[model samples]
Every structure is written in C-alpha cells, then in structure tokens.
Target chain A: MTQLREPLSLISECGLPAALEVMGERWSFLILRAAFNGFVHFEDFSSELGIARNILSNRLARLVDHGVLARERCEHDKRKVEYRMTDKGRELLPAILALRDWGLRHSDSAAPNLVLVDARDGKPIAPITIRAHDDRVLEWGDLAWAEPGDVATAPAEACAEEA
Target chain B: MTQLREPLSLISECGLPAALEVMGERWSFLILRAAFNGFVHFEDFSSELGIARNILSNRLARLVDHGVLARERCEHDKRKVEYRMTDKGRELLPAILALRDWGLRHSDSAAPNLVLVDARDGKPIAPITIRAHDDRVLEWGDLAWAEPGDVATAPAEACAEEA
Candidate 1:
C-alpha cells in the first residue's frame, strides 16, 4: 500500500483530473467494473460491455499502459491475451462502488442487479464514506480545505475554531 | 442517509453505467470537484475550469436536468443564476474524492494540489475504503459476489466457505 502524502495546498491541485485523464472515457469505467466482477478475456469484456472490438482494444491498451491492468499472453493460445487487474487496479473498487451506490440511490431505476459482499462475513459492503481518523462519517458540510501547516496538532481548538 | 440494498444479480444491473450516463463526460467530474470546493456561478466555473462557454453551458444544463445541480436565480440579481449542488450532487463527492485519492497514489504527477480535511476536527480525512458492517477494511481477495438470498446472518463461515 502507498503511504499517505497530503499536499501542502488544496486550491490548485488536479488529483481527480489526473485520474480522469487516465480513466475518464465513458467505456473505461465500465471496463473496470467488468474486470472487478471477474471478466478477463477480451471477448468477455467486449460481450459483457457491448463495446466495439477496436475501441475495446484501445481502451484495454490504455488501461495497461496506465498500470491499471496487466496484459498477459494466454499460455494455451499464443494469439490470445488476457487482461488481469493489478493491485493498483483493485484499489479502484471503492470508486466504482461509490458511483454504483450513488446510482442506486438517485437513479430512476428502481431495481439494481449487482451485490458486492464481504467474503469474510457474507454481508454486503456499505457505500464508501469520507471518515475521520477516529472513524466518524463525514458529509459535505463537515469538510473544508486547509493548508498543511494550518493542521497543527498542538491545539485542537485552533482548528475547530476555523470551522 | 440511504440504506444498503443488495442487488439480486451483478451481471444484469446497470447501476454504474446509469451513473456514468449522467456523469461520464470528461468535464462533469471536474465540475463536481469544483462544486465541492465552493464554486457556484457560471462565470466562476468557466474561468476557474477554463472550459469553453458553449460546452460549459451544455454541461451545466445537463447536470441540472439530471437533478445533480439546482439552478436558481441569485437572490439579489435576477439575471444571474447560481448552480448549487443537490443532495444527489453532494453524494458524488465521495466518488470524486476516491478518484482523487487513486490519482494521488498512482498518477505520474508527484504533487497533488488539494487536500480534503474534516472541518470538525481539522484532521485530514483518510482515503475511502470499502468496509464491512463490522468495520474491517476489505480488498478484492476479501470480497465475493453472491445472490441476495445467499447471504445469511447465521454464520459467516457459510459465506467464507463458499469462497
């Protein structure tokens, strides 16, 4: 796992933009969603997503280049290739799930068809949330941008007052 | 807060795709990111995002139509309309934040400009994670898909063993 490295400034960074640059296309997110559900071969992705062969090929290549997916030649067939999700790719589960959760709640569709379960307990996972270190769920009103230096541990009141 | 609703089947659901249909455009995600940072007016979004007027206008309208944004006349200036996030729009914050977090960890860029902080405690919020009901962080290996009826509360082993 990568270590947390919070930026000193929050006004101008393009973290989300950067991620979007890699995976922003309409088909890319869908492809990742399929990958998470154990879709690996090109045919499987294309059939499941109904994506064009050429576009699917291009998107898969881009995903591989970005290190989100690994393209490996099929051992049984030299001409065939399989795309596997990397650990980095797996980390995207929450983002996709978040989008799915938002859709289920707000979309006009009354019935959804997917369920993400905890293999440990067989219970369904919850929508991803922005939580404090102590694990309290946060909402939009609870968030504010702050400079790295402004986050001083010396006085909790100092920070609370800024709110 | 919405309750968790497990899907009956994962293969046939359009949850993620439906969400993408509303927000799949390249610039929609950026607009939502800016909204989270408190940008509301058309000019503010256009200037800050450097988006073309026609394209920005279209996106704003589409977002409004999708009920993600509420366009209301400014109280003081009837000629000016302010785009405010609806509850649906606010729900997308976690998704955007998840993309930002992934970008921060895996993007080629070494510096991220924005940091999401909890105003209540002045502490930075941790990366969003898919947690179980008992609060254990899960990875791809720790998850499995099952039918709604397959999930039982009696014993977790029944589920783990299925894995």
Candidate 2:
C-alpha cells in the first residue's frame, strides 16, 4: 500500500478552524519562510525549497487568496512574477523570527549553520531577542535580536548553568 | 486582474526542511500543544483546538503514522482510539518549546491567544526565552523577540507598553 507521509488537513466544516488550518501543512510555512528569505521568483522558491510544481502552484495561490503575500512581474522578464510579503504576511514575521530563534537555540553547532547577524556590522544577535508589543517594542528586551553571524549559547547548558 | 501569492510546500520533501516545514503550521503545532495541554480523544482535540473533525482525524492518523504519537483502542470504548505521545513525540519537546517560545515572543496578546504558562504553576514562564548563540549571547538589545509575552520584564511594563 502506498503510504501518505505528510500531515493531512483538519477535517471539518469550520472556517475559523480553517483560518489556522491552511498554515498547518508543513509546506505552508516553508513557502512563507522562503519568501521572507528573499526567494520571490516562482522557480527560485520551487527549486530552493524543492517543492513539487503542482503543490507549489496551489499553496502560493491559496496564500495570496488569504492575503498573506503580494506578487509582481519583473519588467525585464515578463514571464517571472516576484512574490513579496504583505503587511498581514509581514505580521507573521514574529512567527518566523520565533522559528529562527528556535532553530538557533536547538540546532546550535550544526555545521554550515544558518545564523542571523546584523547586516551592517556583521555581528551576532541574541540574549537581547526582540519582542513585539504591538507595532512597537513591548519592553526593553523586545529589542533583543541576533545579528547575521551571532550565535546563542547552547540551550542545554544555559538552563543548567543559569539555574 | 488578480494578484498572485507566493505558495507554500516544505512537507512533501524530506529532511529537517520538511520536518520544520510541516510542523511549522499553526494548527499542527496547536493541536500538538492542545494534546500537551491534556486533550486526548477526538472530540477533546477538536473542541479545544477548534479544528474540524476530518482534519483532526487526518492529522492524528498522520501523526501516529509518523511515530510521533501512538494510539490504543479505548479499553472502555472499543470504538474510540486514545492518543498519547510516544518517546518520539515527547522528544518533540524541543520543537514545541521552540514554537511556544516563538509564539510567546510574537503571537498577539488579544484573541485566541497562544499563551502557555505552566499549567502546573500560574506564574508565567520567564527568563527562559530561547536564544541564538555561538558562545556569546546574540545581541540585538531590544529587537530580539517579536512578542511582548516573552519579555522577562515586569508584566505591567510589558503588557501595557506601547508597541
């Protein structure tokens, strides 16, 4: 028998549930994350994410339909439509940053790691991790962030040491 | 003319990308979170998460298939399958911790809040926020987290602070 390896959608008739439902699939966030990472072109997103063309088409359109993204065609290349984040989508940056922060904490020491650093100075961001109050800083700590190359302390030992 | 949206799909692929992609969805983790919060039966999972039954069914089955969770026919009710996290699923603590850490850091304070204070203790989890490090703490100072809930500062300052 052919095995279905991925998570199936929440099976029901509630739109409110569906609101969070669409984001439940594994592919959904990867797609969203890629857009944030600057992979806007269809081919670039598809290839880098290694997602199937058909599924990619469906998910992308659905995200747009839900108002999470905006797109445009390159003037030089009429065939290419570039995808960008919308205000609503950008609102999801908290979620993305959360994930990136999570990844940095848990996957620390991964070879060829993906780390966030300040673009201007090329320093690391951390301890000072950002927290959003509304459209502004929630506290002095919300301003905390890791720069492009900055790495956080290993989580396992951090807790133990701090404790 | 209609605007286009970038698509989502990281699940169908394999490796940590697919793992992160699939688990990154809202309902997926929320459902898991609900389970962690103590809802086991289909109805409980549905009721608490506000997810549809069909989607819940599919997700549960898929989670079991992935070995992240295990199921047993309810001894008292043969027709019902009770779900429990397997060691594999429990091991997902890091991932879920990452999610909540992110949610607390970014999720809105209003409406269906993604709050996760210890059910055991009323005191909100603080100073345990995740960090990205490479020996030294990443320093974004105030821009680190995206949500006010994660800030370790006093509640009045954090909750009432202007965003």
- Candidate 2 lDDT over A1-163, as tens digits, reads 1222223233211122333444555467778877766678889877876778999888888788767788778889899898888766654553455544444333433332233443333333342232221112122212222221332322464344333
i-RMSD of all predictions: 5.3, 13.6
Each prediction's TM-score versus the true structure: 0.86, 0.49
Q: Judging by DockQ against the true structure, name the best candidate.
A: 1
Q: Evaluate every candidate with DockQ and list the scores.
A: 0.40, 0.09
For residues B1-163, write the lDDT of model 2, one tens digit per residue: 1212223343212124435533543456666655654567888787665667888888888777766678888998898878887655554544444344433333333322223222222222233232333223222232221222332333243223312
- What is the C-alpha lDDT profile of model 1 across B53-122, one tens digit per residue? 9999999999999999999999898889889999889989888888888887786675544456788878
Query: After superposing candidate 1, which stretches have Cα over 4 Å from the reference?
Result: A1-12, A154-163, B1-14, B111-114, B154-163
